[model samples]
Target: MRLPLLLAAVGTAAIASIAPLSANPEVELAAEDMLAPYYAKLERELDLPVAPAGAGLAEDTVLTRIGVGSCNHQSRSQHMWAKIAAADPQLFLFIGDNNYGDNGWEGDAALGSLRAAYAKQAETPELATFRKAVPMMAAWDDHDYGFNDAGASFTPRRWSETLFETFWGSTEEVRSRPGIYDSRIVGEEGRRTQIILLDTRFFRSDLEAMPYSETRPPLGPYVPSTDPDKTMLGEQQWKWLEAELAKPANFRIVASSIQVLTDAHDYEAWENLPLERAKLYRLLAGREESGLVLLSGDRHAGGIYTDTPDETGGEQLWELTSSSLNLAFNNTASNTAREPDPKRLTDFISEENFGLVDIDWAGRTFTMTLRGNQGEERVSRTVSW
Candidate 1:
């Protein structure tokens, strides 16, 4: 088998340096036994012809609208799908933590279970209704990557990648390529929008465990240093991202699973990968023509951030992060007072909320609304370019 560039790097000295815990042999076997039948079903499903897209939705359509969220489990949050589908957006971007794959990887079997979980969620009436209207795209986080807060050091990283590919239904061309950062262009003339999705977790370095301290809350907050060589998108993906951003688009949206602006929620984020975060921001700042905006999910809440240049002279871009189709066990706090930038670093923050973004192709103005479960608008802001 020809190893892709990403697999080649991962199989070599890089991953070898960080020895990972071996999975339990029995769990692997059990997961495989459960997976066999699902794979067969998926093969049949993929064989079905995809529906044709709307005519007006051509590559050069004037405006493009997108819906985004993260940290969803199938058994919970079944109600949110209908409301989300009603929005009738152009695309749905899942920002990761899509599944809770705590079970050890037992080859295709483990993958089968993961795929089955996603299927149940996707088949929900609300999501199914929306799928008929729009296509979906996604990137993986730690949960879906087979471990919580893992990196290149994860034992099943390769297996996890394959499962992600199977679930997302990307073309073989995409699957065969290395690294998951992807770009999409929409609209025509002055209304063009470019969306760049970053793959943050697949090849990440292990986050240093926070040290315990008395003065500080239990664990002292850890922040990433701007090490020139440290990275978030990995080498190839970073190169691809830079080239993608350099293109001429009316607006550019960068989607990340973790907060890029806020320093709070110190477990994992761009803050933990400081050099990579700065490199990304500098890229946006340098691209004067591309009207850049950021999108994120993970915190299980929704909020927005506007880059406010400080007196110390730093550029700040905007970030809009919405999270959780339903709250997870540990992250449920995110649904209650879990602001992405609690320390007041971000311009706006909210908990127990979702978001909707609207774009007016002719007017060149967009509205972003933070909403409650009942679909009542809590916070609304407009962005015009």
Candidate 2:
């Protein structure tokens, strides 16, 4: 029998902040009333993971075009893949929640379900075709990482890491690291582009939820962590990130599985770990000459955001957040389905979509675009440092 997503997500303290009230009958009843169609859609998902498409992306490659997306439930339609493929990006970043492997299950069994989840995604014809055509990089978020909003306390994380390597390939530097964080410097010196994908779950501390009254959707369950002892990337990853930021590159795309610049939202983001968020800003601020662009996923919605923190001066720190390649919950009708973000520079997308970035190496400018299901640029921005 298929399990419900919310039930297993809150099965442990590791994910308590995501939905601590899952045991409440009223909450369950409300869920059923509001999202029955979403549940029905998940029930139809089958276990059918395809074989690995073989590793791609050479170290020497100079990528000017890249695609990004996350929060794809394998059981749903991947209609956006075709559009993303049509855009002809050289590399694609499948940032997080690549599949709902542990969505309705928990414990060791939840981690075990990842095998089939990876299989289901691989067998998807549209996704298969896209991967075969486009060289890709990936990272994991809550659901695909074994539980929703889970972190270091999760026991099955080590096992999940092994499975991730098996399907995504353990050839890169990530294979040697404890967490999934990775970096690549492509192109020659003058045109170097650095791609860094971070692992947000492995060593992250448990999140503290706000009072139950403020824990509802649209309100968000988490508040900025006041405990300075709490960590998001841990000490080792922090050292690694600092080293990566210092590397020579004309442009850098820092990929986080969660949002880094949005402090207004109470969801799972860097803002939830205030100290760590500030640390990241300082690291990037120390090196303002390197063109910086942030890529993030995990939110069901997608949008463009920018911030000019005091650490980084007046220059804008651009962040493009794209998500839910399939399972879109952004509804204009439901006030509870969405919330406001002061840093957002464009309208958020709740439907199937992907983000594409274009860099003009000679001109020293880049364009960030959110492409819709029909291959149209729904939102776009171009700027130079």
List per-prediction Cα lDDT, in the order shown. Answer: 0.62, 0.77
Report the C-alpha displacement of residue 227, candidate 2, in angstroms. 1.3
lDDT by residue (115-215, candidate 1, tens digit) is 55555654566555656666667787777766667665554455556667665665575577665667788877777888778888765665655567667
Candidate 2 lDDT tens digits, 215-260: 3656578888778888999899999999888888889999999998
- Which one is best on TM-score? 2
Reference-based TM-score of each model: 0.76, 0.83
